[model samples]
Target: MTTHTPYGDDPSQYAELTLPDGAPRGVAVLVHGGFWKPEHDIEHAQPLVPSLVEAGWATWAIEYRRGTGAADTLADVRAAIAACPVEHPVRVAIGHSAGGHLAAWAATQQVGLTHVVSQAGVLDLRAAHDAGLGGGAVARFLGHPPGEADAGVDPIRQVPLAVPLWCVHGRADDVVPLAQSQAYVAAATAAGGAAELIEVAGDHFDVIDPASEAWARVLGLIEQLGRPAG
Candidate 1:
């Protein structure tokens, strides 16, 4: 995998690796989940990059500042998307865990991101905070308690655009729980947006285990979303 930091000024900050293909369907940005904390780095997503490259889709795995400034992660995402070849036909944003929340936010801020996929993502920040998942490092990223941010930045409160939304969750997930994705699907549907919620056998980590069936399901969703531009 070739490494190039889109924002070279940031140093070896966020590295991107694009699959080598003559005519690719499009590109997918895989946002790794770490609850927007410093402990979980982008290296955690390295294993899944090859699988995406094999599928004829280019993938960009991003790294950003976590914690209270984590809200700025969207800026890094926009930079990554802008760094890609403008001719790519389709573009999809995919993320796991906390990254899912960021992906959803990115979709709202930018145009041309035709699809979004959240894998066992923490979609409802308010719910997460209430469930005690938003404390500590998470609280720092959110910059507020669950009760306060619930009305503003919560994915559940956002109005999704016409872009196709896919939410995948493990039936056995205990970290973020399946309810996170369930809540998001409900909100997207209520907003008159197209959203699909898929359930698979596994837990939070198992779903993204790469070798697990759930990972395959995620890849399938990406292929469907990253259709040839035309």
Candidate 2:
């Protein structure tokens, strides 16, 4: 672990970078999820980062302002990626829960992020809001109802994300629910984007635990990202 690097003047606009033992196979930008709330910081990413670094990938765990306006949150992501030290190519975004939403949304923009791994991301803002998940966290993040936000604000609206997006959703996840990943993959593939869903057994937090099989599954996905699909 290296010192925190600031992408912008704001305190929230920073990232923690970790290098691998040898040459990195790629770069991974980690986004933590706390249902887009201020209380949820980037520290929760610890469980997931080591696995990535041990896998021989340089990792950047970013922190952004939560519950802030949509644009502000997204600006943080774009800047963090831009500020990352380019130790290698094959830049990828790995976001969990609320972070999953950020990762998927990042791909819709010109953020230079080529691939995405959404772990139980709140991909569908409208659906999330409708289901009232996170106790109205979606509405709080939008600063308005989800219906009022632009189509681009929702990841589901931006299908065929112009990059490969793999969603790892826990079948037993009651937080974001497996439906989020299922619907996203359905929409993404239907729109011609390279999207996949890997169903695993566990709750929302299981996906982040390094000791869990879910993390093992994620490691496999990272390996696949470095290789050209045959």
Candidate 3:
């Protein structure tokens, strides 16, 4: 079973921590997706907790504030990360959709992570802005257009983060599109970052579904990424 704790005073600023049967090899910080909205809560990520715990990872799934503003949303994420218990040897973040963007952004911000997994993430804010993703989520997130936004906020723009990134995207996803991950990985690799793009067969949510092959691939990737404590 998973236990919950508050990282911040806000109800949304809580996290769920679950330990494995034996000593955990690492910690997997799970971030959920909702196009940066408050309506979508952390319940979506709860289903995958069992699989991660079964794989010997102490899962720390965070619930962050959103739709308030970019700074507050990111601030909540960073704070939640800071509050995470560092009892394991390795620590990695696995985020889905908008959470993936936050995970990548967190990596760039030097959150002391070993690696990052962006599962069908919205990595390119400029492109997403141009394409009008999530009904102008980038604009809502930045409170302005891409041209007026800062480069620090965009994951694809911030290539070569100190930590490596594994971008897993569903090829059949119409929500975020496979090109999002592909473009980000291409740019990161070109900039000398160990960013890899892994395409799986399914839609956006398939990457999070415990029974799906994409989810299995994601677990395998996380396992490979769990190197000796960095």
Candidate 4:
């Protein structure tokens, strides 16, 4: 059974936990993307939780306040990650689209995360703001244009990730250009960080859909993340 636990007072500041039937291989924190809008909540990510649970993972599908602005959205993610039990064998985060951006950002905060996976994530805030992706969604989230936004939160600007990172993007994703992941991976690698970009044949949503082949690749990456470091 799944359990809903609130990390904060806000209705959006909650996470749905899906426990495995037996000993879990690890814990996965799932973040959904809806252009950082209120209309897109955690429900869209619910379908992926069962798959993770079946794979012997305890999943925490987080819901953070979006559309309000970047600060609130980020705060909620940070709080939810902090709420994770320290006794878990491993902890990884997977985020799609805007959530991908958050997942990457969270890894840089020295949050004790084991690994991070960005599935079609918006890693470059400046580029995203310049391209006007999601109809000025970045500007709305940051409350400023890319040039004036905080550098700390911009994943591309903050290179040399603290934890292992894997980015999976669909080659056919028209909504968020594949270049977003490419540039971030390149930047992270140049900074002497451990990062990789996995390209697949699918659209934006394919990476998040549990039944899609793109999701199968995501699962493989997650499995790699759970492996012990040699």
Model 3 clash pairs are none
Clashes of each: 2, 0, 0, 0
- TM-score per prediction, in order, is 0.90, 0.95, 0.95, 0.95
The residue ranges of model 4 lying beyond 4 angstroms of the native Cα positions read: 227-230
| Cα misplacement distance, residue 205 of candidate 3 (Å) | 0.9
lDDT digits (tens) for residues 38-66 of candidate 2 = 89999888667887888878888999877
**Predicted structure 3: lDDT:** 0.88
* lDDT values, one for every candidate: 0.75, 0.87, 0.88, 0.87
Which tens-of-lDDT digit does each residue in 14-61 have in candidate 4? 888888876777889898998898899888789999888888788889
C-alpha RMSD between model 2 and the true structure? 2.4
Off by over 4 Å in 1: 134-137, 147-152
Taking all chains together, the TM-score of candidate 4 against the true structure is 0.95
Model 2 — TM-score against the truth? 0.95
Better of 1 and 2 by lDDT: 2
Candidate 1, 116-160: lDDT as tens digits: 888888888767877887355456775656675345456777866
Residue 230, candidate 4: Cα error in Å is 17
Question: How many angstroms is residue 40 displaced in model 4 relative to the true structure, after the best TM-score fit?
Answer: 0.6
- Which candidate number would show the highest lDDT if scored against the true structure? 3
